[model samples]
Target: MTEEKRIPMATIGFTTEDAREAARDSFYLDELDRQAEIASNSIFHAIMRGRETKNPHDPRVWGALQNTLFATICIARLLKPGPVREYPGLTKQQSQKYADERGEKLRKMLDVEDDCHILDVKAVRDAYEHYDEFFDRHLRDVS
Candidate 1:
């Protein structure tokens, strides 16, 4: 019979918890990468759809632009230093503040000289997301 050799846990220099933490970190990074790739693909599809129509006012073109905008926002948020979190109780202003902080962190990390324009998409996103309220406000103003 052949003898089997095994390394002791002490020689490994890391606890099982450390391994678990590392695995969790890796999984998080992989998930972020996957989401970014999906967003990129959405942007690519949007570009292709936009190219298919010459009229900017076309519904297809508008839809594509909307997708591109949302995708860009996703990518921008992904660029932030840590995992994204959802604060269900946060108000709109608080949420915007959090986003601004994340964007600033990313910009600083990247050594960007100019403002991160991608962060500015929140207003456009909000308008689209709350289109009913936006349209109602506009109608009220017009009346």
Candidate 2:
């Protein structure tokens, strides 16, 4: 008779150490690093193109700039994982709060400072999500 292997399910709300440990060892970390680098470069190139265009009203320039910022935020989110979202044990609100706290630390670690142009990356993301009309303003006038 052939032996069958059984994968153990979570007994309670806690994630299995094996799963977390596997994630730590996974190539996903390396991939995330690579993706971050690519997104950074993309932002730089987009800004360069915008400058070269020398036209404030150029849609291509504005589109690239906006897309890059959104891409950067997405990459940042991928780099920050939440235990509740990945595993279990917390309410949705609690999970979101925990993720937000971690995201704040990540922003600081990345030296993401708010200024006249960009008050907050997360806020920008939220605005983009909650208000489509926000984009109607001239991109050049964004600042």
Candidate 3:
């Protein structure tokens, strides 16, 4: 058998604890999605059966128009988590790994040198600094 060299792989920045934390977050998000979908489907089914339009803006037949507000909220939460990513349960290793991968992708995305006068190293640095702001801005504010 020939000996083969293997590269040392860096962790994705998630510890077992971090993985658990992420898993919890993921579970909550999934549950939120499920509940929202179910409510939407119910409203859709009701409107279909009723076959009456309360308002042009109102999709449902003559139900309390206010209920639509709750439905809209569920839909919004499904799309965006609001500002709730605050608080704790965040891990440094996990954060670092996310930052590294995000940085790498942003760096690799630059096709030309000095597109922003960024050398490869500078590119990674720029990407690193930009990632959080980019992520935050892109983060769904309503959902």
Top model number, lDDT:
1
C-alpha displacement of 87 in model 2, angstroms? Answer: 6.9
Give the per-residue lDDT of model 3 (tens digit) for 52-81: 644556545424323433454543433332
Q: Which stretches of candidate 3 lie over 4 Å from their true place?
A: 1-15, 52-68, 81-143
Which lDDT tens digits does candidate 2 get at residues 1-143?
99999984432233888766455434344444666676677778777887788778887766766676676565556445334363278778787777777556554655654341333356667676766565565464666
* By lDDT: ranked, best first: 1, 2, 3
| Candidate 1 TM-score versus the reference | 0.49
lDDT of each: 0.62, 0.60, 0.48
Q: Which one wins on TM-score?
A: 1
Q: Estimate each model's TM-score.
A: 0.49, 0.47, 0.32
**Residue-by-residue lDDT tens digits, candidate 1, 1-143:** 99999963323234698786555445444555665576667677767877887876877756656766766566556454234445688876676677667556545655653456754666777778899986787798684
Off by over 4 Å in 2: 1-28, 79-120, 135-143
Full-model lDDT, candidate 2 = 0.60
